[model samples]
Target: MPPDLDPRLTPARPDLADICLRGQVAAERFVEGRPARIAVPSAPLRRRPDVAAGLDTEAVMGDAVTVYDVRDGFAFAQIVRDAYVGYLPEAALGPADPAPTHRVAALRTFVYPAPDLKRPPIAHLSLGAAFAAQAREGEYWQLASGGSVFAGHAVPLGHTEPDAAALAERLVGTPYLWGGRTTLGLDCSGLVQLCLESAGLVCPRDADQQERALGTALPPGLDGLCRGDLVFWKGHVGMMLDAERLIHANGHHMAVAVEPLAVAVARIAEKSFGAVTSIRRLAMTAELAETGAFTPSAAS
Candidate 1:
């Protein structure tokens, strides 16, 4: 019942009776062990920042995280039947499907976020949210989890998709935090991820997380990036709204603001005292959200 509730995660299940799943079910298909959704009375369950794997199964001393509000990584219903709760690196409460999904994918984000710590945003997903995905690189159907790429185990977003641009615009003025992804505040990649997830596009939680979502990386020069394209500087990420302009929720700007792409680059270059890392486009689909996806070559 409940897709893959293996009675392990659901220790209360009548079927398990004497079976001790330790308040969780076994990992079957997309199911995973996660904290039960209930209201808590005290401090939240904040895992170690370096927490690698065995998250759901680790020791829980105090009250478990009830009333889910994770904003960093995906959470599951069980450590191993409820697969990935959101499949993206962010969660609030209630369902994640918003703005009316236009596409959906069954991709559980744990496939990517779990393995790529640099791309943690993919971990913030909720139970039963809208999923939107399409065929990408002929194999994995790209899901929009925050703003990155993640490899997963045989899952696909369901068909009812939502408008990505509309979703992206909704979170336009959200603030930027080094590692935040919520309406209260968010970083560049966080904004991108939440915006896309709102549209049912499951994505990862990092700038590099954006690479596969776009299918291919743009050549490293500024000339290769176009309007709506994204650029990455080591840990930093921004969106190229036009040839000369980009928008992002940057700590430098202290909020979600727009500036010339070159100016931002100059600032970061000046700050880091080194060469910019790389430049990339927003997910290929977003271009359709603007110029109908027929953008001219940036080389022009």
Candidate 2:
């Protein structure tokens, strides 16, 4: 077994492993996982089966997953989007079919039971949630899963945002929730992951992993920084709104907020987060791969 494999992203466990890793890992049983999709609005992927267990991340509507095991109402699965492995509620999953054709582009939107706006909402889909549109009414897109969503809030597959910084700007003031990934809440890395993924770039879920896998590192000292540059601290990450301003989902404000980069640097240092470890510039040169897998030393 390769010690470099990150447990957070690897599907191998002592008792079970994804069949793809049969030769690479030691497991009592290896199985070809069953395909599934997140049916609920958003489901927490927790580190353990218990409700009180720590949340690793979240899987939103239409996200694909491969279920390896089901026990105690929780399914041990690997999210196909990022290869993140965790346990999510079995009830939140539905058959993976009627492939998604559109992605929610709005920060948040409501899905109505009928095409009429007057109808009560059946569910709320956040940015990056996927849904297949089977038909279009006057102003609504009838979903393949039996609901209607405002057509303007979603875009056809392959449509990409112009830039991630602008997208991050629109999310300012959203509450900061550790392990969250939706507009409802999100942490530093989660915010980065959301914005980058929306812009058609692949991003890792944790700060350290992102620091390693993301764009080219700039020369030290934060000189010549521009919009969309990523700043990293040991356990934290933030994006440059521009040369002077920094935007981040931080605990200091408990919300996504902006401030001068120098001020943030000073305060963060005073609080013992250490200095900026690296500054990365996402050139957007690489396209998003069909499958995102990770190989990093276990950390975070």
Candidate 3:
């Protein structure tokens, strides 16, 4: 594989590659990938097939993935939502039919064996997880795969949250996880990605990709910072809560935390990540606000 091709996004290897890449790269063979959907509530996508390998990200229920190759118990696949390629446990996948019609909107929710909430839950789903709803029974939605989830916890696929910053702030105190994007645990980029998705914006998976592709870059300075502004370091990213505060999932706190931008900048600079590389502001939707700005008081 050429060094220029990012392995994180490319479904190619020296031995095999996706048929879609036939003309773009050299490989021993190319094959049309098989389509699959994530069956479990959440499955880790790792850099390597081994469980010990670093997790690159996660695929949630009903997410479409293309399986380019399978070995042992792992499938080398690419998630359609973000085009992220990694090794996922083969057991985590299922048939791609009965496509999703709703997505989990709550931070976390339970899948019950029956419509009754009193029943023991079978599985837990996190925000952004997709599911196919076959019918409504009382206050629960019957899933195509056989289960019921609280109807209020999910919304139609087209639904979107009004404020990205406020939505992210709801996850304050989420545990810092290297490659997780669930309420169970999450990383800096994962937090930003989830929040952006809630606001109906497409975002790339990693911080470096997010910095390079998301929003319009603002000239160097903290004076113009506002809610929804993305503050990026070399390998990390965070959202500004306002002109003075920033919220991020950080190893230093091992959780999502909010602090003055000046304090975070000085601490991060003195400790490890060096300094802020850029501050980019997202184009606000009309729903975000008429003035395209957010205040903590209003959210409260």
lDDT of 3 at 244: 82
Off by over 4 Å in 3: 285-300
RMSD of 2: 6.6
Worst 10 residues of 2 by lDDT: 291-300
Pairs that collide, model 2: none
Q: In terms of TM-score, how similar is model 2 to the real structure? A: 0.93
**Which of the two, 1 or 2, has more lDDT?**
2
Instruction: Report the lDDT of model 1 for residue 143.
Output: 45
Tens digits of lDDT, candidate 2, 19-119: 98988889999999999999989999998889999888999999999999999899999999888999999999999998899999999999999988898
Error of 1 at 247 (Å): 1.1
State each model's C-alpha RMSD to the native.
15.7, 6.6, 1.9
Best by lDDT: 3
Query: How do the predictions measure up, each by TM-score?
Result: 0.47, 0.93, 0.96
Local distance difference test, per candidate?
0.43, 0.88, 0.90
Judged by lDDT against the true structure, how good is candidate 3?
Answer: 0.90
Per-residue lDDT of 144-236 in model 3, one digit per residue for the tens?
999999999999999999878888899999999999898899999999999998789999999999998998888898885667889999999
